[model samples]
Target: MKIPFSPPYINEAVIQEVNSALESGWITTGPKVKRLEELVCKYTLAPNTLCVNSATSGLMLALKWYGIGEGDEVIIPAYTYAATALAVIHVGATPVMVDVEKDFNIATHEIEKVITKKTKAIIPVDIAGWPCNYSDIYAIINKKKELFIPKHENQEKLGRVLVISDSAHSIGATYKSEYLGKITDITVFSFHAVKNVTTAEGGAVCINLPEPFKNQDEYNYLRCFSLNGQTKDAFTKSKAGDWRYDIIYPGLKMNMPDILAAIGVAQLPEYFEKTLQNRVEIYEYYHTFFKTKSWAILPPYKSDDKTSSCHLYALRIKDISESERDAIIDKISKEGVAVNVHFQPLPMLSLFKEMGFDIDNYPVAYNNYKSEISLPIYPQLTKNELEYIVSTVTNAVESSL
Candidate 1:
């Protein structure tokens, strides 16, 4: 009855895809990667999509493209994974840590207050597959339109603040009838093993920019940037008598390999309704079981206006201290049910604390951290296994208290 937390749902199909890729000699950042990018665009309905090695790379690329550097500031929720904030620092910008709301996502109402003249971008994280309240954040951005400085002094007004979404936990999520990736200026998706879909370790960046970037050349430039800023891709260079090329810029190498993309391509057609539906079933089961427990503050279900990917089933123990939370986690593990914490808040981590970030400043994020626990939620769990998990959690929580 031992249940592990967040196991990768790999099967024969994934193996078969990998085998096909191995058979094909051209496996490094080739046609398969290109095909996955195209499928991602079609699924998300984004203007353009670029596949990368990981979501961390995708975030860094987005920030770099937006020209966020030294003296620039990026606003992000303190409750997210460290990678979200680390990506900002990697771009040589200061990450202004902000408190998240009670739901473990960005504090939309408080974002406007944090916007300063040096604010170059706002990275709102979609925690545990729940999309942040983008409408409110968009309202704040729209009202502060005067704060934006155009790329050129007399050119058409382009918004200075880029709305980059850290959508690593939310690929199938929807916001206001549109997919999460298509809703933001730049949205990044993680296809890590434990994610809803897996490319072993991969991600994609989808851009929804308007106006000046409407041309195809703009998309081509983005593709070029992912491949060491080369004028042409390896696929193009492999063509007859096309070996000659030129370097455009000093770009980083974060291209997705065809071997990884082969899994993605095979998984895409089977993913849409099948993978998500299984996850939804798991989520709904948890919801039903936790309904009678006053101590359990269940994760949000899909509303008429929005839908989550149900990536993680995070349960909060009402009125519990941090010690109690830790004890509960220990008890669950002892009973053969592995439980985990979503995050510990960036300001509390050693590196961030050494960097002079104080945890007391973000009370909501700390409070969320104190009581939260992420249970096992994946596509492979059977009815018996799910019941075992529920009973194990129930026994653990009651005994721990």
Candidate 2:
């Protein structure tokens, strides 16, 4: 009766795609990568999409392109994983960590309070595939628009604060009846192993900008940025009499190889309606099962304005300390049912602490962290396995108490 948490849904179709890619001699950034980018554009309805090696790289590129740098400040929720804050730090910007709402999203009021003239961007993380309140975030940015200072051309072109969505867990999510890529200035999605849709080790950056700034230009620039800022990709260079290329920007090597892109193309065709439907059903079942328990504090998966991708079932244990929550997780593990915690807020982590942040300042983030335990909700779980998970989790929780 052993159950693992959040394994990627790999089937024969994914393997076939990988096999086809292996057979193809052009394995690095070729037709398959181009096709995946096109599929991403069609699926998300974003004007342009760029596939990168990982979500961290996508977020970093977005920050760099938006002109976030030394002396500039990027606001982020303290409740998110370290990658959210790390991107800001790696770009040499000061990360102003804000408290999160009870729903594990950055507080709009907190965002406003921390915003100053140095504020260049705000990275709002969809902690568990649930879309944050972008409408309210947009409103806050509009109110504070007067204070934002542009340090570079790209930033000035937008003429306002940039909203870079850390949508690592929320690829297929919807906000205000529109896809996630449409809500933010730039949205980064992860295709890590545990994600709802995986590409082994890959990510995509969806650019959505207004009239003054062109998404096509941004996409072209990002393509270069992902490939060591090369003037031509490997595919183009392979053409006869086209071995010439140039380095345009001081970009890192982060382009997605064709093999990984092949997997993405296979997994993406029926993602929204077919693949994601399984996760939604599993999430709903957990919600229904947990509601009858007094100790269960359910995660917000569905609301009037948004529906999550059901990436993580981050259930909280009401009135419990962090130790108690850990004890419950240990009990479940010993019983062969694997569970996890979505995150420990950035301030509590060693890196942010050394950087002069205090977890006490982010009371809301710590409160949310102390009692949270993420349950399994992948697309591959059978009915019998799910039932066993439910019973084992219930029994383990009671035993721990």
Candidate 3:
């Protein structure tokens, strides 16, 4: 029984929604996209949300909206998807890579060391669906606001160095009793096919800022920025008598289409409990099996104040070289049971190396990357298929020794 990594769980609802969009003729970023954005905002309990083409775009827009650019720096976990750091660079800001904690999420304690005069923001990623220590991050940000970059004399008084979260893997995760989207200044969610909740190819940014930035009416302005930084979106300009609009800024085209949002809106109703429950069951199955293995170090599950979204199940084999990890993956694939690695630390990748980052400097991230392996935990896996996966992993591990 060949068990693949993560086959998207699509049903008739998704297909019908797409068919409806195709039939509507207004399949671009139109009414359906607006409805999806509303659903996302309601689900995340966020004051505002903007749907975009991808999570990378969501992160880039967040950084741009916060005015982080040249002469500024943003701290990020070295262990996250490259998209996290790449978004920082996309906005012309320096990405200060920091080591993660033993659990493999961003180390909240280390954020203070990297804080400097140029530090404009801190982007703590919720790697593998486990929420970062947002309370600690919030405490640190409030206590150390003096270390952040000073506000421009002309610009409005900025809030504390913006706490943007790369919550790509944590749509349903909670930190300190609040959902991920509400726990930070800004949070980005990826609805990629393999994610916990999928929209085929889509993402959303949830804004939880205080005061003047909290205007509910600004959602249209955000949609405009996503379209092309224009004063009016294509939807408004397409009206019978309103075709004129002005460019507000040099923005990029990354808006989510109603075609994609159709899937999103259909999938959202099943997100909170049903989909999450299936993922959790898979997670628990893996945990029950691997916890007894002496060489297998499991990822974090429980925390003092957080609950995971049960995203990626990253397992580390103790005392193994990076080559050994690769060999294990090869062995597993050979058994017709597909598996994958979560990420290679950004600094180890050539793009980052060219940008003057050294992998050796981030010892913890390198260590985590070398020892880690991600198992398939999607909802579609049957009980028998899961058993095969577990047996295959067990055989591969014992054989590797």
All candidates: TM-score? 0.96, 0.98, 0.96
Model 2, 1-401: lDDT tens per residue?
78988777878888999899999888999899889889988988988999999899999999999878999999999998788888888999999999999999999889989889999999999989999999999999999889978879988889899999999999899999988887899999998878877789999999999988889998999999889989999999999999999997998899999999888888988687698898899999999999999989999988898999888999898898999888888888987888989799998888989999999998989989999989988888999988988888899787776
lDDT of 3 by residue, 4-85 (tens): 8888888899899989999987888888888888888788798888899999999998888777889899999989888999
- The candidate that achieves the highest lDDT relative to the unseen native structure: 2
Model 2, residue 238: distance off in Å is 0.8
Q: Among all windows of ten consecutive residues in candidate 1, which has the lowest summed lDDT?
A: 149-158
lDDT of 1 by residue, 241-284 (tens): 99999998888899999999988888876777598888898999
**Each candidate's root-mean-square deviation in Å?**
1.7, 1.0, 1.6
Report the lDDT of model 2 for residue 48. 90
lDDT of each model, Cα atoms only? 0.86, 0.90, 0.85
Q: Which ten-residue region of model 2 has the weakest summed lDDT?
A: 268-277
Which candidate tops TM-score?
A: 2
Ranking of all predicted structures according to TM-score, beginning with the best and ending with the worst:
2, 1, 3
Query: Which residue pairs show collisions in model 2?
Result: none
Write down the TM-score for model 2: 0.98
